[model samples]
Target: MNSDTRPLPQFAHAPLLLLIIAFLMMQPLSTDLYLASLPTLSSDFKVPLSTVQLTLSLFVIGFGSAQLVIGPLSDRYGRRPVLLWGLALYAVGSVLCGLAPSIELLILARFLQAVGCCSAVMIARAIVRDAYDPVHSVKVIARASTWLSLAPLLAPILGSYLQVAFGWRAAFAVHTLLSVSLLLLTFLRLPETNLHKNPGATNFAGLSHSFRLVLGSREFWAYALPGALSYGSIFAFISGASIVLIQVLHVPTAYFGYCFAIGVSGYLSGTLVCRRLLSRLGATATFRIGSAISLGAGTLFLAAVLAGFAHWSVMVAAMFLTLSAHGINFPIGQSGAVSPFPRQAGTAAGLMGALSMLVAFIVGSIVGATHNGTLYPLGLVVCALGLSIFAATRLLAPAEAAA
Candidate 1:
């Protein structure tokens, strides 16, 4: 089963591509599809907005933390079993979320759901690394990212309708059904892509060594940290958007999905551009350009809010530009992080994913705590993260060029 020695059984390219896209979509679908219900959930459970927001943070924490275990397990065992088990857990979590009568229960359910959903994300990245060479890996990841952007683009719009038509719980119900269907498909169609299995790597001693190999690499961190910060800024927006849009600027709940979609489109557009630019400019150059744009857009956003022009349209436009920068940043960062460690792809993917989600959770919690019914907090936080990305990219450039 050593991937280096044995050839993988060829599967249908289209079907496999579709499944990978589905796997990549699950995390966002779980989170974004239920977001329009945040305000409703707060009212239903008789909790404050901040308490409801804690569920989001907890989910991210669970999701990020679980990757530490899931990634290594997949590297030790195989991708298929781990993926099926993860989807099953997600299904159970979603069902519990749908049935929960208390906010506490719902928060617990969301955390479990996040933990389960993370397997899909980590495994999806691992599979790409397993199947492709380093040169083609970035292209494949960029394509997958382009498709992944659709989840954010469409999930909120669909979730909004579900919330309006049924209730906040309806999104979870739908999530449960989708997870079950994906589980069946994985069992039936998905082949074991991880031909190389490090059975000993599951032990604590081996796990620590694998982690050190990933963490000790300056190139890995140089790409991963900026990418994670860039990606986390989106979560910051997700956390603060409901209050800023619904409470402060007074956009109706039903139309909130459309507004969110506008910003997500920026990510989609950036992915498209990344796909084209990757061949010409290469990852590091493209990533640096994206970092610059994101920094500029975030600065503009903060200035707008500071200058008292905190209209919904202005915020959305600024976010759109920032997200576009994210579109370019994410795939390049992810591909770069895992590319150097071919044998330990799962561990590398897991570490990178964990750091990103952990950062997102921290930023999301900060947004929740700083909720003052204004766009100032969100703007400031995003600007700070954007600046951090710029700084990281600058620091990494010399090492990146040498590599």
Candidate 2:
């Protein structure tokens, strides 16, 4: 169907918005909820922190790579079927993750779980495109992201408690249950949103063309680069924070969630700020401010660590500032990247999401590899990603504003 020429609905129904928020939450929920268990996992499996880190880095690899296919498959078939199957796979993978006896097995399971969970996030953006015009979709995504931040805010806290009470594997048990529940909800309540299905989307030539169409657009990279880097900064924290907070700084494992929650609260706050800024300033202006905050916060963080202020509070505070900026940049980035390709929204969403995860995987690997039992590496990564985000914004904002 030629949806490119048609006017999309101005807004999505309220129920669908809830589903989208819930779907989007899967990504954070998958990682953050078990983050507090990283140390415990390392101890239990008789492995080093770097080996345990593989679970996360590999999950990003699977999640990012799968979206390349899932998004196109949704565009070829429809969002509903793909989502249903994805949730089911997630449930199975979660179960496997909980049952695995070895770190290697757990890493493999995480990759599987990630592959399934990718559908929720990638399709959520596509559905937004199906329902709204580009400009309006940005507003909708930003507002939804405000609610979505709650996952990261609460997941770690909940995970910490769950770890103390039952064990690290409890997180996967919860994931299994949640995935099943979401699966039922999808099957019963979620309607098909991809009305403009392109039969050729899954074909090799068609997929390549769709990719080129999105990639060739200057607008997509402008947002995608900043978005990926901001997320990379956050991932740097996610992959490294537990060790820093619990091992180096001597924070209690049980208390780690509260500290993590404080940083994530920045994301919630940033999303609120994002909605306000978008109303008054527009996308390009919002990007500029957000990127500046990210760069400035990252610099302060690295400087603090370098000056021998290697405190958990410093790390958490720095994360809070940078992630708050992420809250601002991410929605704008996602909407902007997909905006130019109405008919190729799934392809655009997938490609953008893939880039974010790819950057995250690289960042996570670096953090893992460079862990010298000190704060310097994490600080360097966050600062470098922030600088990159600022650079990308500077290059794109003027052009976007002019356009």
Candidate 3:
């Protein structure tokens, strides 16, 4: 669809809004619900803490890898059918995760769940890009991000309560219901948004050419790579936060939710702030500024830990700042990277998301592997990503940032 032809939507179309919002909400739910189960899942699996951690890493890996394949397919086919299939797969995976008798089985099931979940999220971003320009797209994504951000923030608390009440398996049961309902909603209400579809037009060569164009652009990577790293940093926390909160600080199990809620507020704040600023500073400049704060926060977090003054409260505060920084960085990076590629919004969103997941996998693997009951390594890596983003933007120069 031509950008000029599609007028900006003002939330009147509840069906379309629900379509994307439903998909968007699942991510946070997945992260949050699953995260709370981490501690209990280890004992249930009869596996080492590190191995249980692998489940989270693999979920991200499956989630990221699947996006590249599904995004392009949706672009070729249609959004509704792809979303339907993916959600169904996710539901099946959820059932498997809930019923699994072994840690190995649980890990495998989580991977499957993630693989199926990838389609909705990737398509959500592409759908926005398909319908709106960079500015409007930023706002839409930021608005959606609040729902997404809350998932991880609230997930642990929710997961913790569910784990305490029933068992780790019950959490998956809840996920299964949500996934099924979304699937039914899709069959009943979903619509076509792929304005760029043409079976005969975009052959293999056209597909290759579009990807090549994305790769050859310095700005795409300039925005994408750093954004990916920022998430990598966040993954470090995702993988390690439970350890720091529950294991190290010896916080009451029930109180873990409170800490997670506090950090989540930062993300919510960033989302609200970005909406106000996207029109003024634009995605590029706003993203650069956010990157600086992320980097700065990471460094300060590292120093505090090294000085032997860092505690759970201190780390929680640092995390809040960094999460907020991510809130701002993600919407801008997402909108900016895809802004230059309107025709292939699905493909573009898929590729950017894939890069992000890959980065997160790498960082998460490192943090998970070398965990030593300290946040030093994780904090350092997050700071490094922030700096890299800042450096990349400086080198690319604002004039050429969106190249």
lDDT of each: 0.88, 0.91, 0.77
Local accuracy of candidate 1 as per-residue lDDT tens digits, 128-232 = 888766777777777878889999999889998999999999999989999999999989888888888998779988899999999999889988999899978
Which residue runs does candidate 1 get wrong by more than 4 Å? 1-14, 398-403
Clashing residue pair totals per candidate (backbone < 3 A): 0, 0, 2
Give candidate 2's error at residue 167 in angstroms. Answer: 0.5
Model 3 global lDDT (CA atoms, 0 to 1) = 0.77
Give lDDT tens digits, candidate 3, residues 51-84. 9887888888999988777877877887778888
- For candidate 1, give the lDDT of residue 293: 86
Error of 2 at 364 (Å): 0.2
Task: Decide which is better by lDDT, 2 or 3.
Answer: 2
Local lDDT at 304 for model 3: 83
lDDT of 2 by residue, 126-173 (tens): 988887666678888888899999999999999999999999989999
Pull out the clashing pairs in model 2: none
TM-score of each prediction: 0.96, 0.96, 0.93
